[model samples]
Target chain A: MSNKLLECVPNFSEGRNKEVIERIVDPFRKTEGVKLLDYSADKDHNRLVVTVIGDPEGLKKSVLEAMAVAVKEIDMNNHKGEHPRMGAVDVVPFIPVRNVTMEEAVELAKEVARQAAEKFNLPVYLYEDAATSPDRQNLASIRKGQFEGFKEKIKKPEWKPDFGPAEVHPTAGVTAVGARMPLVAFNVNLGTDNIEIADAIARKVRYIGGGLRYCKAIGVDLKERGIVQISMNMTNYTKTSLYQAYELIKVEARRYGVNVVGSELIGILPAQALIDVAVYYLGVENFSEEQILENRLLWG
Target chain B: MSNKLLECVPNFSEGRNKEVIERIVDPFRKTEGVKLLDYSADKDHNRLVVTVIGDPEGLKKSVLEAMAVAVKEIDMNNHKGEHPRMGAVDVVPFIPVRNVTMEEAVELAKEVARQAAEKFNLPVYLYEDAATSPDRQNLASIRKGQFEGFKEKIKKPEWKPDFGPAEVHPTAGVTAVGARMPLVAFNVNLGTDNIEIADAIARKVRYIGGGLRYCKAIGVDLKERGIVQISMNMTNYTKTSLYQAYELIKVEARRYGVNVVGSELIGILPAQALIDVAVYYLGVENFSEEQILENRLLWG
Candidate 1:
């Protein structure tokens, strides 16, 4: 609660079983200092994503506790799911929320990795900011073989785990721990149901399409709502803001004789991203986040 | 900070002396749970306003400590200022910011008032929501005739102090303590420099002229910026939001062909006020404040 905030989103393998999910999520709910922001279990993906925020000490403790439950409940040998995951506790990413620096978050992730490997005898990959090597930085590259293929892939000289034995565990499998910036799930809905308008805007507003450098967007048709939405993941809000993508979509839609009906923020987002919108739209000059009342309390 | 949040803005007389001002504000900064959100001194008005937020216990302790300092340093008999005053420590307002209700805030104000009356032997009047009588609810009515007049005014039956001795303190004078909703100091700058357009729009957008219920607006000329401004105090953002005021001002400005050049928020404001702007402009339906990352932590 006293500044130095860190956000941990740990993805566990068990999602379908009601009792198992509860057991895995118990530590996060019961932890004193940790604030469980969100937790969801998708039956189709058979994956659980738990979002929690707290100081370094409390967050790390809660994460390891949840990891232990996931290890005990999920047996990778018999586990089957559509999502590509390499372990029972698939990916644990520590994001710097407030006063915490990315380097500090990386150190925290490494600490968790070091602890998990010894306590559970599970192979851990330090991906992203905590990655030992350049190739290990991408979670997908490290998780290329999945749990089954990783059993043999671990024997490769280049594919050695960062912690624990050079071999995979019997039940728990492998997990990725790292640090990364906060991602914003922002979507802009178009006036017309025609998805073509959405696709056109998405191309003009995404990184690969030579638009905003930090955006990854795709057109989605909300069939029930009778609109087309440019569902987006703002990978780096600081670099390419929500307003940047939103305004571009508005501009692109105008060419097609379409209006942006509305926009949506799908999941949780950092408060600064939202405040930036107000500052931009209102043309409030030299406005600092310090002026936000709640922020002063949390800044600690 | 754990859900039961309260905002206290304590205004004290004597703004010219920086040494005395710091002494008054030091307790709020030193207290553990209390957060010093903002503090400003107006030389002309000769007043010091300190905005702090904390839990009930911590907030109460800081306010009382500051009151003692004001009592020791300031003597109303020799005090002279342009602004209205009835005490060394003039007014203390408790506001519900996050999860705390208005009723709970009123209770907190009462506790502070009772303690101030006992410790400092100062006459205390509860205004706004904490007022025992309807007449006392309005601070101005209770503060009639200023410090020089309140001595004789207190002899009347209707003017009996809510707490403390029936008479005011020999040096400290009398103060008002109460609870109320958070106010937003919002100002919209017009493209034109003409003061008439700003005045006309202000009349159309304020409550007295049949506009938004919770808005009080005035026209101002920002000579340095060469723009006329519609300065406003949105007394209740929940009922009359920033976007509502901004949008209405835009619509009204159309008649005079003056674009809203910019807007500014003076001092501190609740985070929800800014979030509400994004929700309205973006057309985000069914969005909850709980979804804000920083808020999730502060919600406790």
Candidate 2:
């Protein structure tokens, strides 16, 4: 069998200090069986996001190493960011990319969370598919109180993490580790500059508005381009595809007499996402990923 | 730079004999850096088609080994098959799958052809992008006389073999070796079984009929299913994408009051072919293959 590939995206609290960000991400570089696809630090959010993929064992080892570095360098007491956070090494989500099942991914995430908690003496909360309780399934719920408020909130019986002590660590507050489906950040730009039109369409097509499930959307202003954009996070492309979101946006925009200028994918996505759309548009029957020559060789 | 991937599909004349087929395909198995994607034999055609992909050097070495096995075991003088053939190890076409340019693939093909000719003392003809002359560019023209007639046909000045002596091998005959773009065997099934409608649409959409430049299409009857198919060999997907053919077929079928039931890809195709169609249908303004996380790791 081919190696099981798992994608890990870990968010660190220190994004302003370039040296600290590099130190946290350094472990993923030049590691055997581990490929560091991308890492970016946002000053405004004061957070660093690192993306890496590889064999399950190799990836777990590299991510642990990076976590150790983050624990040593970052202190949540002094952390300040626009994005919500409950720890120095904030959230680490393990996504199944290829030849891996969700159950296996969940087990891997739990193992990592256990190891991190035991070694670093840092609190680790299991969220998403790997959550210990239904209430903790959402990261926002786990991080409801941010780093400062988490100190008192951790003592609550329901807020107790799946792993680690009831109290937050002195430096690295806490971390959320779990398994989840791959997320696609897709943005659609409208010909008009009216933000209200973009907002209305976002509301009409998003899951919150009883539109498509597995979609989270918001409107943004692209002032320089003189256009309004509906940015979406397609959390589960298998159930709700990119094309589905695009078509819905197009149909919703028609109400306001707005034409879709174009769309863009923000970051990396699994190849299957695009293949699904292609199969739909081309009306191909009985198509398989194995029919892709490159995929065959890669899996082998 | 990453390793350049090249796909080689070689046809051998002895398909009826399982042992001979296995012998010809043995080299591709257990070879480091060389992946044997598929190998199949057709009794009616009396041919074995093997698909392998790897680095240029490794692929060339494996192909030569397979050719030597074919030359020693199969004697084309006594061969009989439905498919046209001029050699024991008939034709080998090198395709650029990733990171390799057409010129590089052509060079690789020539080197392999030269080695095969010198080692086995067999006549080799270069066709497609690696053709030495315009007349030699089409494999059909080189294979016109077949193995039985090649003895006299090869003696002509314009028919001089690109490699080895002008005379064909007593047992193996001649081989056609060259580079070409990946071919997608896409078949579109029509709602109706009217063979004439399928034939007219094929003629209207194929290159010979002043339709798409890179498409070669023919009509086929699927008797058991009670449907007609527009069988096509999309020679260059980069120039004429799968969607272009699919949409054109949909439009053409409408004129005949027939709707397309479904389409199928006969064999392995490059992932780019499907991705291109998805990008077109999605109206993605700036999409890159690198954005595919699995592809990034595979290519790296």
Candidate 3:
């Protein structure tokens, strides 16, 4: 692990257009030192999310280049999506991957936000760990009414932009830049097709409803698979491990006589999270990362 | 993620002499492109094992340079150790770490063996997947009576050197070079200190006694800890996962009402092995290596 490594997940407003989405993510591939881990465009939400990992210096340069492309190609005023949005390059969150701390990631986010706000004259709101105000800690609060409604909402003394002018950019819109922990999108499917059961279980497991501290969950009907799923976004795996959340769900579902048929980790996850699950389930008393041969090879 | 990565574990005959062991292992660290993953000198065994991983070309050069040092610094004729041995530069195994195949690793082993034999005139024996004869496939069989007895044993046609003259080097002695799958040193300690019960369980679970294939296990007393351990060497983890072995041992130990205290992975292991354990334990229905964030980050 290198102390300089950082993880960045940037959201873009236009996900429906394949060409435009590729163009926006092209900078991550073209840029040196940055590793483009994953990128996906959701058609229904009309949103694109790109996952990138690299050194702080390299990632800062890559995000600027990506923003330059997104600003020119995307017209946020015409953007129509089910998901919330504030800019063409909607939200950029810097995450400390390894050998780096949250505080350092916050500093990196501020540096990136400063550059984007100054160079493009676009308003930037720091959310989560990089928030300038306590009200900015939650992204929903920062982007309460999306771009159109929030455009006028800015100019208020409490809603002034963290960077850029009080006015929102007409076409490009304002962007949210912040630091956050790595988020793991995990879901478990039950044997029964009862969507109600899944919903009740989700309510009991989500943080908003006094469940797992770092989890936000919802139950969805998987029509094609003929099952219901408790889709969850584990915002912080270290605080609430996959095993702890999964066993809780399993135990909760069993009360309704529902058997967990399967589970899915939708996106990239940290190696330690998986190791934690392994150690828990296998009863591997004192297994360390060095016990993993591939890890040893990488360290070597 | 590199296409040409290779891992080499070289064992030398001098562990007691810190200076001699250091001199023998220094070339691996000094060599360009080669990463010295780890090295250990065991006084009880009087042997040094140096682990190196890197580009194939650089690894081969480094191994040869290290062997030159071993040949000049150590003499096997007067060598004394608790562990079995055959030469100053005893055994060198080329392991395919990533983006490499067993056949390619075999080719590499043969090439290194040829160079060692031609340069140092030390007789070489190929074992494991690189063995020419079925009898030679087992390294213990190749080193049957160790260095002292093997000198006279080499006179037979069945013990002919794979790459050198029929005779062993006068001072450095003979060497064994081969290609092998990564071996995981996994052990499960029992809460009780009954060596007899542990031995009985080991026999029932070891491959030779019709247990798991690709698994070699034995029972030993952890005297200082007051526990009996089922020490295991998983020769091929892809075939027999770590959880499978641990589960079997748990079942076998339960007959005598013994519980598992802890387990340990003695050295470096492949990341896939840990991933396999994670998938098994987490009940992750459909997981891919891409789901591991660190793996994806390393891909670039």
Which model scores highest in lDDT? 2
Docking class of 1: medium
Candidate lDDT scores, in order, read 0.89, 0.91, 0.87
Give a tens-digit lDDT track for model 2, residues B170-284: 9999999999999999999999989999999999999999889999999999999999999999999999998989899999998998999998988898888888998888889
Candidate 1 displacement at residue B291 in angstroms: 0.7
What is the C-alpha lDDT profile of model 1 across B82-118, one tens digit per residue? 9999999999999988678999999999999999999
Candidate 1: where is the Cα deviation over 4 Å?
A17-23, A26-34, A57-65, A114-121, A130-138, A141-145, A151-168, B16-36, B41-44, B57-65, B107-124, B131-144, B149-170
Residue-wise C-alpha lDDT for candidate 3, range B1-300, written one tens digit per residue: 246787899999999998888788888888887888889999889999998888788888999999999999898888999999999999999998778899999999999999999998889999999999999999899987888887799999999999999987888888999999889888888998899988988898889988999889999999999999999999999898989889998899889999988787777776778778878866777688878776775554
Q: How accurate is candidate 3 locally (lDDT)?
A: 0.87
DockQ values of all predictions: 0.61, 0.76, 0.63
Higher-TM-score candidate among 1 and 3? 3
Candidate 2 lDDT over residue span A1-300, tens digit each: 238888899999988998888888888995678889999999989999999988888888889999999999998888888999888899999999887999999999999999999999988999999998899898998899898898899999988888988889999999999999999999999999999999999999899898899999999999999999999999999999999999999999888888999988888988788999999887789998889876786774
Q: After superposing candidate 2, which stretches have Cα over 4 Å from the reference?
A: none
iRMSD, all candidates: 1.5, 1.2, 2.1
Clashes of each: 0, 0, 6
Q: Report the CAPRI category for model 2.
A: medium
Q: Candidate 2 clash total?
A: 0
Worst 10 residues of 1 chain A by lDDT: A291-300
